[model samples]
Target chain A: MQISQQQRQLIQLFRHPDEVEFSNIDWEALILTGRQNGFLARLYYQLERHQRLEDLPQYAFKHLHSAKVFADAQRQQAIFEANEINNSLSAIEISPVFLKGTAYTLLDHPVAYGRIFNDIDVLVPKPLIEKTEKQMLLYTWFPEPIDEYDQHYYRQWVHEIPPLKHASRRTIADVHHNILPPISGRAPNIDLFTQYKIKTEYQCYVLSPAALTLHSLVHLFFEEDFSKGFRDLSDLHILFSTHYQDEKYWQQLRFLAYETGFTLELFLACHYCEAILQTAIPFTFKHELVAFSPSPMQLKCLNWIFLRVLQPSHPNYESTSYRLARLLAMLRGHIKKMPIRILLYHTGHKLIKAFERGILGRYSDTSSNLQPQPPDKNN
Target chain B: MQLHQLKFDDYIHKMTNDGLCLDLGVGVFRFKSHITSVQQNVYEMYADYNITEDKPADFHACVKLAKGPRHYINPQVHFESDVVTPFLPLPKSQAFPLLEWGMNWCLSAYDFNHFILHAGVIANQQNEAFVFPAPPGSGKSTLTAFLAYSGWRLLSDELAIVTPDSLTISPFVRPVCLKNNSIKLVKDWFPQVKFTDTATDTTKGDVAHFKPPANSVKQINTPAQIKAIIFPRYMPNVPVTVFKLDIIEASEAIASNSFNHNVLGEEGFKTLVKLVENVPCVELQYSDVNEVATFLQNEEW
Candidate 1:
């Protein structure tokens, strides 16, 4: 909800790269923090846009420039993967709805221009999810060899199936039936998103602007991982700046969120996008978003946690209270996504694993050669 | 000021407290380590290196001695490159060795500005760089340490920070890491060279790092133009053999040893072509350092 002084330096430069006052900045911390928050290359783009790259110290300039080169390569690879997946799934009469990073790349969204993607995320209709996975496996994409209990957990409750990784290429693709897990009881009807699909230039399907923005918002607010919080919020700012129109546009986005049972997500996204990123949301929408807000006490607590978590730091460097915030936020995420009984079961199972790894000196699977190989046991 | 100017106690206090900020030729690093082995290694190996006091560093790395219930039973030291541990904590005995490995990891992973080649580099008195590009067990580091003590200046033991288009490499004159039998053989051969205690049963067998010659560290800021690429392999009891490689053959061999040329793609290919065209490549196989050193001396650049 608020930027730290460190975040302010980064956000300020993002807003006005050409005008950045060099004297006040700690170039080392600034560079590392920018990189940690997934903004280094994006910041390169900003600085490049303003023709201010020449002003940076050579070391800073090289790192930022190098990040752009890397991000560009990753984006190209993602595009190639999306088209390959599109070609594969087309045989089964399913055009997967690419989401998040893949969708952003397919659409050539500037916000994602300099970002990295861990995997390609796509959604298919619930009925086709099985067929889609079978097709993927037939085409040399196998479910990642996760543990048996984890496999059961994903199958029983998670939004997506186990990730399907390409055999030779080792690239990952997340095939999802719903954006939100069905156990959330608030997973939107898939058809609502499907209606707005626009075929990309490469023939991969992506949601139209409004629906896409709504989904991004939902993903941002619901996910516990705040490591990419700044990147996601920055993306929303870019999307809003491009998509913002008169009252009708805001109204349509709100209606979609309401119809899809994500009014709360929409509210949080709008409030934070404006508050943190300084996005120019219409005053009318701001007033209307208030209706979706939690109580003042809840808001205060949310701000306390989100502010610290949003200013991302690597886990090792995190202060004890910040780690506590992350833990609370993670538990809060579990509660938000699962029913009470399922949440308890899932939490207990994970707690035991954590205990074994931490207190019981299992340490890691370092000495073990028991990793699941081909002909995965999960299937 | 050079690091050797500080008293040993003062250096350890500074390294553990305010951190030892080293301008390591290729990149500046702030090393904050409480581990005695790590501190001692820095003191011994980095005596002639410049210290950038109170300056912002390029990387903030640490070798922290692990603390927990497991600590007393099985002590380990984490090799954290900046905010994250690049590798799992190693046995506390391996602290100094881990730091050496961590420094290389930091350069390869974070210093995207240059072509960080997986090669050992040594420059003759004229500052003409000779690159020995080889994978592990190829005796690259061993050969590099052997040459550095035998009058050549060591540029780098693990990574060669090649500046693209400049056709030059900045000296990365840290300690040369020796593995397994080579550690003992090297220590015996070069009796005067200071070496860290052998870190037993490391991933690279028994590993130890010996200091670069002081002359190399003294010229840490000097950049050397590469003159020859010698792909070396240690063949026990083999006769000294030197085979000249044509440009294409040399290009392919050096390319395999380059870490980030793949990252650079076509541009890197062009640079590799230009380098091979300018610098002759050769393959050397020998067990005797004396024979290999004499061969290198007699060869035309």
Candidate 2:
């Protein structure tokens, strides 16, 4: 509940806007140490206003450094677009997903639009995946060794094949055969997905609204990847909030999941959207259509919290709540999957380690920076 | 307003109530009076003296700190000697925001063991943090401003701090740097967003850094694990496409854009690699923002 000193200072600055001064001393302490974007922005504005920045010869020199970054973005974008087009053409059935510049910008607003990309993404037909692989080689897009296992796994068991990379662009894109995994232990019929495709200026493939939401939820949870969840969450928030007005949308969503053999994804999607996005699904639809048990939002919130506790800094209030839900869900997962004996053993081990790292005040040589040596690694 | 003594030539001063600390230059000095300390140095700067004057007329009236040579300055002016850095002119905006946003990848890059990532971040009202990490042409700043202005909470528009845990993303709340056409892109998108004057042709090509929204300005230090690390490259006449990157490969890409990977050593590398491993990485190629938003709505992060 308490605000950090930095946050408190922000409040003071906002209240007494004019008196706030950005001096060189402030620059070294606050700006150099700062790790966030907001502080950088505020500083930029303050310097420009005072006119003190422009007068300094050194400041003008620094401007060149930032300018180069801008130029690189422009060049990188050109390279990315070329690769995406090439990748799409080579794939048997190329369908674009939530590529922010290509799709997110088209759907979302301008604020989420910053940053340059170095790659492209597209979905290809499952059956022609092997052939698509052949075409990719022609375009110089190859697979990394790490994806060797993923490719095999996806080809045999999952909805999307292992991601492919372009040798030239150094960018990789995933090729999806279906929106979600075939939970029934069989490849979910491809026709079911292709049948729901909506064509745009980009291409002729997209998951249905119901399917997209279910797939998004499954991706968020079952996939357990949060890299782009912020953007994805924003998207889901908008999609569900905007589409929920249609009374029949929920029924259709349930029907798609059931028919596509990803009923679990549907259940989870509803669980997360409501828990994090505060998305509302109709009660009648929940009762009559989605008979499959939906995970409780309260429990999900707890699961999220446990995961969030690992953050170096406490998450914002909403993030904290969601983390709690996610934490609870994680526990539920462990309980459902692991035997009681194994769970107890794992819990005991974790507790012992936590005690050592926390209460004992012992800094073990193993984890401590006892030895200073050069690190051997590269990009 | 209390001054304390310290060991070694290096003097120390800090705010008792806050996280502000300063390292003044080395010197052997005695307190001249209760409220003021006098020393003869490179010109004579007084420690604590309250004088009512703007740019003092007489330079010798101030207590002189004798280090090497006599440097002349107004006696009434209270120089910030607490911090080791030399006196600098006042910044245009608030101190915290200006320094937080403006001092990245500049002359003196601090060793934080994490890259000063150039990206924009935003969270929804729900506080789900999404990061768009890209170079200038990637349309990152433009997209960030658009998203923040639209509905999502603006976490940052420049630096995306990736901790050793790699899962945590700290907020920077820096201004969104809009270049050339993007200045119009954002202004046209959200007429309400405030912007600093567009400085012409300094480096980032007809650049203007958009002021952080009032709400976003307050939460600059709040950190979140990157929900998404998007690499956006804009291309005219190209259809929108998003590609998912494998974690290992994504790690390489992320590393390339890192500002402090070299300084962070193994822990930094491991953290970043693990981050890309756990999070989904994608390349977005697009020309329009609306479709991009629609596509974003369709995918699961």
Which candidate's TM-score is highest?
1
Off by over 4 Å in 1: A1-4, A91-93, A245-252, A283-301, A312-325, A360-362, A366-379, B243-252, B276-278
DockQ of candidate 2 relative to the true structure: 0.02
Ten contiguous residues minimizing lDDT sum, candidate 2 chain A: A370-379
lDDT of 2 by residue, A1-379 (tens): 3334443333333223355553322322232222121223223333444444454333222332232233234334534453465445636554444332333322332212332333343455666667766666677776656323334545654565556676765556565656445532434565665565454444433455655555555555543423334334434554566566776567667776778666764665555556543556667765663566545784455434423322112132235455555455466545543456755865786577656644433232244322222111100
What TM-score against the true fold does each predicted structure earn?
A: 0.91, 0.39
Clashes of each: 0, 118
The residue pairs that clash in candidate 1, if any, are none
Q: Give the docking tier of candidate 1.
A: acceptable
Error of 2 at B17 (Å): 13
**Reference-based lDDT, residue B55, model 1:** 63
Question: Model 1, A1-379: lDDT tens per residue?
Answer: 3334667788889887767887778777778888788788889888887888888877788778777767777787789899999998998788899988888899987767888778999899888888999999998999866788878888888789988889987889999988898889978898988888888888899987778899888887777777787888888888887767756557778888888988888887877777777888877788888898988999888877766666646543567777777777777777888999998888798788766666534346433223322110000
RMSD to true structure for each model, in Å: 4.2, 23.0
lDDT of residue B255 for candidate 1: 85
